[model samples]
Target: MERLLINIKISVNEKIYLKDPESSDLGKRILKHSIELIHSIGFECFNFKKLGKEIGSNESSIYRYFENKHKLLLYLTSWYWGWLEYKLVFSTNGISNPKNQLIKAIEIICDVIREDSRFSHINEVKLSKILIAEYSKSYLTKEVDDENKEGYFSIYKRLIIRIKEMIGQVNPKYQYPASLASSIVEGALHQHFLREHFPLITDCSDTKTTTSFYSDLVLKTIQK
Candidate 1:
C-alpha cells in the first residue's frame, strides 16, 4: 500500500490555497512547519508569522501560498481527508463481503494514526492530531455555506457517501445509512478527543477500545 501511495497525489480543492505547496521546496516547508507549529501551539495561537519563523521564511512568503492562516487550516484539513480517503479506498477495495468491508472501513477510520513514510514532508500522525483537535474550525464558519457551494468539503462528504453505501450493502432496508456513516466518521474523532481530555466520560481509552466500540455499534444498528 505504501508503494502504491508513493504515486498518489491526494489533491485538495484548488480554491483552498493560493498556491500548491507540493510544487516547490519553500511551499513544502510551509506545509511541513505549519503542521508542526499548529500541532505545537494550537490553531488559535497559530499564525503565518510563527509558521514563517519556524520555516525560516518571511511571513509575506507564506502568504503568497496561503492568503491567511484560516485558509492554510482548510488546506491542511482538506489534504488530510483526501489522504485518508485514499487509504480507505485502497484498503477496502477488494473485500467481497459487505460486513467485512464495512468492518475494515471502520477500523481504518478509527485506528490510531502513525507517520506514513510515503509523504515525508507532512506527518500523518501530527496531521491526525490536528484533525482531532482543530478540524471543525475549517468549516464551522459564517462562510461555510458559500464554501460548501464551492465544493471545499467534497472529499469529506464523499467519504461519508462511501460508508453510507457500504452500510446499505450490509442492510438493504436501513433507513439512515448516511446519518450512521457520518456519525461513525465524526464520532470517531470525538471519541478520540474525549479519550485524551475527558477520559472519565468515554469508554474509549485507546485505539482498540475506540475501534471496538464503533464496530459493535454499527454492526448491531444495521443488523438484519
Candidate 2:
C-alpha cells in the first residue's frame, strides 16, 4: 500500500534558498512557524529573531534556511503559486471543454482556500490570506529584476501562461490572453482583500457569491 500511495510536494526554486527547508525537521519547523508568525503579526514586523523564538530555535539556525525575511517571503509566495499550479492541473485534468476548464480554473482561484494535510508544514488557507494581503510585497522591491532573473516569480508566470493558453483555446481570436489571465488572478486577489477589509467595495457578501462573480466574469469576457 505504501508503494500505491502518492505524496505531493510543492518545489520552490533552489536559488531562493541557502538550505532546502523541506529537507530537514528543523527547516520544516522554521517554515511552518514562520507562516504562522507572519500571518499573525504581518510581514513588516516579522523577523528571524522573532521566528526563532516562536519555533524554539536560535536566529542563526533559522538563517541556515533563508538569507533574510524577504527571501522567506519569496519562498512562501513561490511555494503558494507552485501548489496552486498543481491544483489547477489536477482540478482541470481530462476536461474536454475549454470553457468548462476555464470556469473550473476561475473557481479554483477565486473560491475560499482550505488547508491540505499533504503539506503538513504549510497551512494553505492562511497562505491564501497572505497572498491576498501581502503577495505584492514579494516582488515590489528594488531587487525585483534580480529576483526575476533567479526565477523567483517563474511559477506565478507559468500559472498565468497555463490559464492564458486555456483562454486562447476558448477564444482563439482573443488578442489579450496574457493580460486577461493576469487581470483575473490579480483582480481575484484584490477582491479577496477588499472583502476582508472593506466589504462595501465588493459585490460578494460570501465566498460562494465571490466565486460566482469571477466565474461569470471569465465566461462573459472571453465569450464577448
- Per TM-score, the best of the predicted structures is 1
* Consecutive 10-residue window with the lowest summed lDDT within model 2: 1-10
**Model 2: per-residue Cα lDDT at residue 40:** 97
* Pairs of colliding residues, candidate 1: none
lDDT of 1 by residue, 81-145 (tens): 89889999999998999999999999989988988888889999999999999999998999999
Cα error, candidate 2, residue 45 (Å): 0.5
lDDT of 2 by residue, 1-224 (tens): 32222586788999999999999999999889988998999999999999989989889998889999999999999999898888888888878899899989988887889987778899999988989989999999999999899888999999999999999999999989999999888888998888889988888866456669877877788888
Model 2 scores a C-alpha lDDT of 0.88
Clash totals, every prediction: 0, 0
Q: Report RMSD (Å) for each prediction in the order shown.
A: 1.1, 2.0
Sequence-dependent TM-score of model 1: 0.97
lDDT scores in order: 0.91, 0.88
